[model samples]
Target: MSLEHSGGENADSDLYRIRHSLAHVMAQAVLDMRPGSTLGFGPPIADGFYYDFVLSEALNEDDFPEIERRMRRILKQGQRFYREELGADEALARIDEMGEPYKREYAQELLSREDLDGLSFYRNGSFLDMCEGPHVDTTRDIPRDAFKLRSVAGAYWRGDSDNVMMTRIYAWAFDTREALDAHVTAFELAQERDHKKLGRELDIFHLDELVGRGLPLWLPNGAVLREELEKLAKELEFRAGYERVATPHLARADLYRKSGHLPYYADDMFPMMELREAGDDGEAVKEAYVLRPMNCPHHHSIFAARPRSYRELPLRLAEYGHVYRFEESGAVSGLLRVRGMCMNDAHIYCTEEQIRSEFKGVMQMYAEAYAAFGLSDYRVRLSRWDPEDGKRREKYVDNPEAWEYCEGIVAEVLDDMEVDYVDGPGEAAFYGPKIDILCRTVTGREEQLGTVQLDFAQPGRLGLVYVGADGAEHTPYCIHRAPLSTHERMAAFLIEHFGGAFPTWLAPVQVRVITVSDQFDEYGHAVVDRLRRRFVRAEIAARSDTVSKKIREGTTRKIPNLLIIGEREQADGTVTLRRYGIRRQQTLPLDEFEAWIAEQIASRALP
Candidate 1:
């Protein structure tokens, strides 16, 4: 249900084997039921496993009960998994004889693409599949009550849109039934707190097809969330000695080329636009431009714009820059993955000698911001390049010395800070190593919310230099940090984190003043105006509705505070206050209430 699988642990664990073996068992059961169903791929996922099939009959959830029963029956037989190795041609022949055309085709493609000694197949009972697996020794090893079929959906064969769509059966598997039940409960809760659903119900943001996919238009309320987050980031950055700067949304293609993003990250970028203009010599000059995928290049250009001295070391430049990425349509989901985003990005140009303190300062800022947001369930990951990887040169900067130097600096700082972090080999950026802040969502899925990367190559490549105390120019190490990530991702996290009931300071409407009746309308307006003057984001609900209805509406809208004004409240200089998710209601003097709410807002109190 809520299984947390690290990349390394999940690959070879016994749980993985159970899930893998279960996939084959499920496949056999499906084939037994349908009689003519052909299989594609069946691989274990984080929580469970799924198999793709070209079914002769259309299948739905209604048919799952029978399929699951058959799976249990097969599991009770205690079938032993036997592994066999055969030549590629023999494997293809066997697959063809089994009448699995997709498997035969995949085997052929693999044989052509890879240099292999032979192909391996695993046979459990009468079911045979082409898989390189370390499956459970026997069907008895899989818990009978710990797995269940979850849902059915269409998935393209081989994940290619041009290929035929196959029916995919998803299932959940765990070591124990209790784990499965816990995961199911968490999953149900996650569905209720889904950001996409809350975003619509709360009127925060909208994704319109006319505007294109993965591009969200923030409604008024959603814009308020974004602005509040920006305000918070600016305040923190200012105190941290970060200078705010504005960068254009698009820059010349040459800028990205110099930053090494073009050759390495071109696929994720929009196509370049070429422009031609007449030069002073009457010759046509051609230039290419692209939407900025990141703010680092622009910041680098700023650092290179003028000569710098060591006194200006750690020249921190920050921006809430708008960036665009060419995310695939299928990959984009709600605000978590989008084509357009506003990044809380910054670059610190510091000398090699100052890299430790500068990097530590960024981490401190991240900790402080997380504390303010009440985010404690997160882990730091030290992502590094795998020197042993065969294509390390192609995947990372091809300078081992620079890689060692920068990675050592990062590791030393993290060690000195005594931060607990996991090593993520082969997860580094193309240019350098990075520290990723991975936050676990309510559903138990891990999401990367923030990152800080150390770059030793980009500055030299971009011609960024500062005069050293020795009076000679030297390259400054560039530290790229984004504690709050992007506006979209952060808002999505917060939406689910708080279940749309944001704290007072972050709520779009902090308070709603509702009149008990027409007689209290004037008083409600006065209270709202007073609150508004204090910048409390207060509004008045003076419609001819009942007091209960108005309060219910305000509660449903997730207003953190609701003020009810009646004859008594108007007669005295007092107001009745209702707080979201709180049962008690208190009536206090208007001035006293204002002071308390102001303190809450000022402190950014979390509920």
Candidate 2:
């Protein structure tokens, strides 16, 4: 993980220096405890710092307290941190004298590969290591009560699996004890709301070794969540003048090459499959196909299938297209990162003058969908290309003029809509610039949940054109958008956002009818039938358990509404209702309860 400050301080701030200095101090303490241990890399990370070491002995969680105590003693020594600069040969000699093989190897590699003029080393008391100097002047700058060693794990040297495994010691650091405590509490809450754990408990989705990693099998309940989301997307897209379309999951390799995704995105796509077919002359012909990693190319093919006129300018094609990607084994995690996903994807083919209006409509649709989901903690980012990058031709389409014009158009739209967005230089898509919607997860990390990319290269490459009113062929601009993202990612987000207790409409099991005793089983089934006829996802809990036990079970499953079918309620054609996360209960006529629930679901009311 990238380093992040616990107090929201940047790397050049005082808190960062303190954290960096603490890492060195911790290294000093560890070296004192294990005399022959050699250090690798010690860097400050999110919330704290960690030091990697090739230890002479094994370490475990049991040793954290003693190591922390030694660290505190070193902090009290008030050792001054001194920096020294040396040439390449001098640095290598110093590393050799220090008897650290990893440091010497890394120094040599840096000198040979990066061609650095020199190297810098820092020293505190008798301990010295090769590092750039931004450390605190003295060890006393670290607060004793604000930091604690978190855990020890094995990490490959320099994060390369081919290298030797080293012991990594992690610690949590903050500017104050209160901030550290608050972080601890929030971390615990995040663990409690972790999707993997809740997914199994709620029976939402599952991962099996046989089915393959990163491919989730959505259980019955999980399918409900997905279908409901797709229903919402279809309704919104239909009202916005979008025409739904379907495409195959795989396509010919030449298709991607034509769309400029082959050389740039080949590594992330699955291996190509070759087939032999009979040619027109009865000879064997070879063909190749691969699983598509995106839906835009296929949509472009649809747009180019027939000749078009200027009247069909802003043709919007939407699809829940299933795409496959070859994610690294280590990068695949639950539903967040997956190999197979059904993207809520679409492409808008519009003229140059119509680009702004079409793009603004997409943004407005996103706002409407987010408002319906009650999602407010998100920011819009204008990810632009960098012209000064050394490998600009390889990283981006080297069209400076098109890049400038498209980026200006997107910025103008955001300005006209009064949307607050931050500029993200060097983060644009390879084809062109894009607008990214980043939402903050419950764990305090921002994730890119949706995107709208302006493409100026693909349509021309794919030969997509329309006849203008002047009777000339003109290239149209394509806007690739996904407001709801993929079902897997959105479901994961909603699972965490609502803590698995979704609102009435989105809940997997909307209502459960519990019979007070086996005698009330008939009434429970009748009530469930009535609710199901009204299109509510209702079930009958007709077990021979007590009323209180049945109610507890329904609540545990996170059923939003529970209807009690007892003798008194059955006799009067009424039902006692209990809502999840609420303490009060009420008795109402069965017809009245049905009407109230239908309205609640129709309005998509939140708890």
Candidate 3:
């Protein structure tokens, strides 16, 4: 699903060229197998390539083998690729002769463009495709065994659900069979660590159509995990001198316009809420309010609530604000992409001279947070501004000096801290440059875990100022950071990172006391009560099942520690402890075991 290239390489490599050519060959084979099929766009992706087509008969995975065989035959024919350039009018005529209505429409659109000179077409065998020329010389360049048809799914014409749906055929191509096999193994491992499946199996979260698409209802266990993460964030922010503040979930529309997010982020934001009031002339005036898509605008207002002085420089306001975004139905996954999320958001108002130290402090906060969660594999991205071309200038604020100054400050701070990072141009926010933390999941997926943005535009636009030491008013720079990301995304990342087996500090139920038989049930309750008294999440499983069965059930829940109470343990006033993912069992006194578990939770151990 990720189309981003890997290994610090661009999309123009030889593998990319091979994949692109394979897509055209696959389309040709599909047309030969199903004669009346119509083709849409086919692009080379990160792993492989996929093509969209409309067929007279429904196609499924069962049809892949036959289609692949036909593709092999075409490959064996050793057809040479030839490129042809033609005027748009001539290209449309050729497409019409081939009876490809969709291709004809595409060619006509390109012809309507005044800037374009002509169209480029590639031909191999009896098939011709409109494309840029970067294909292999002949069909023999494709390895017969290096390509495979993956699967079939329904996709909209251009990813818009309102458009006509087409059957999309996915395929994988690689330089060699060994590389393909390794990728296959990695993909299978990723499937095993998929958070959606683990969320259900672990009773962490669920999505119901009755509630609505992309809205997830957190079960009790999941809520506990969310709260634990929030608690950790609050503790860190508090120690770093951040003041906690609350904000409304809905705000007036003009607020976003002032922050410069209205027209830019409108599509991703939920629809506006309009309220009407009667006027004196019998006319109604409407005021629009939108669900908060971000917390920065509101924080800006808070900074401008009163006049600030130089003594109050570096004012940090923090919040665990809940935000709503109108993600398209197709883009929403279980917890990774959802309609509602709680952001561990905060903004710092600091003098220009304090930007470096403030930014470094935020990086230190990230280090502490990742250490708490035992997250180690992550990279930093310093997202800078793109060259201000006509349209690109409109995309960013028109302050070249401010952009350069802010970018220089971030780079200096990163260099001072000796942090490893990569440059990402054109990935900054509309008003500022940002440092994005990218964490690599166990599944070989990189996720944007947190961000720290330096904004020199919003404070000026929102009229935020403070008196300098010289008794003159000056605009303050803003630093927006979230070391811990939204709870939904963080949970998904942790679930996959730990394979649904959370650490002691973050686990929903740290201890489960199991009774071996009916007679020892009393001892099991006593242990649960004692652990609960110490604020440990504990439960007693007193079901009348075999001890092995109870152990298996507890293991499935992934509880960090399991205490088994049998006749001998009851007589000895002790318990047998079984740790998850370990084969050894150690017997200890009840009080000693309780103290050890409490210490693990208090220290936030990674056990």
Best by TM-score: 2
Candidate 3, overall lDDT? 0.87
**Candidate 1 lDDT over residue span 481-590, tens digit each:** 99999999999999988899999999999999988898888888888888889999999987899888998899999899998889899999799999998979999999
Put down candidate 3 lDDT per residue, 414-506, tens digits, no spaces. Answer: 999999999988888888999999987665667789999999888998899999989999999999898899999999998998888899889
What tens digits encode model 2's per-residue C-alpha lDDT throughout 331-365? Answer: 89888889999999999999999999999999998
So what's the TM-score on candidate 3? 0.83
Clashing pairs in 1: none
Off by over 4 Å in 1: 1-21, 33-47, 51-63, 72-125, 128-146, 152-168, 174-182, 277-285, 442-444
What TM-score does candidate 1 reach? 0.85
* Candidate 1 displacement at residue 71 in angstroms: 2.3
| Global lDDT scores for all candidate models | 0.89, 0.89, 0.87
Report the candidate with higher lDDT, 1 versus 3. Answer: 1
Q: Clash totals for all models, in order?
A: 0, 0, 0
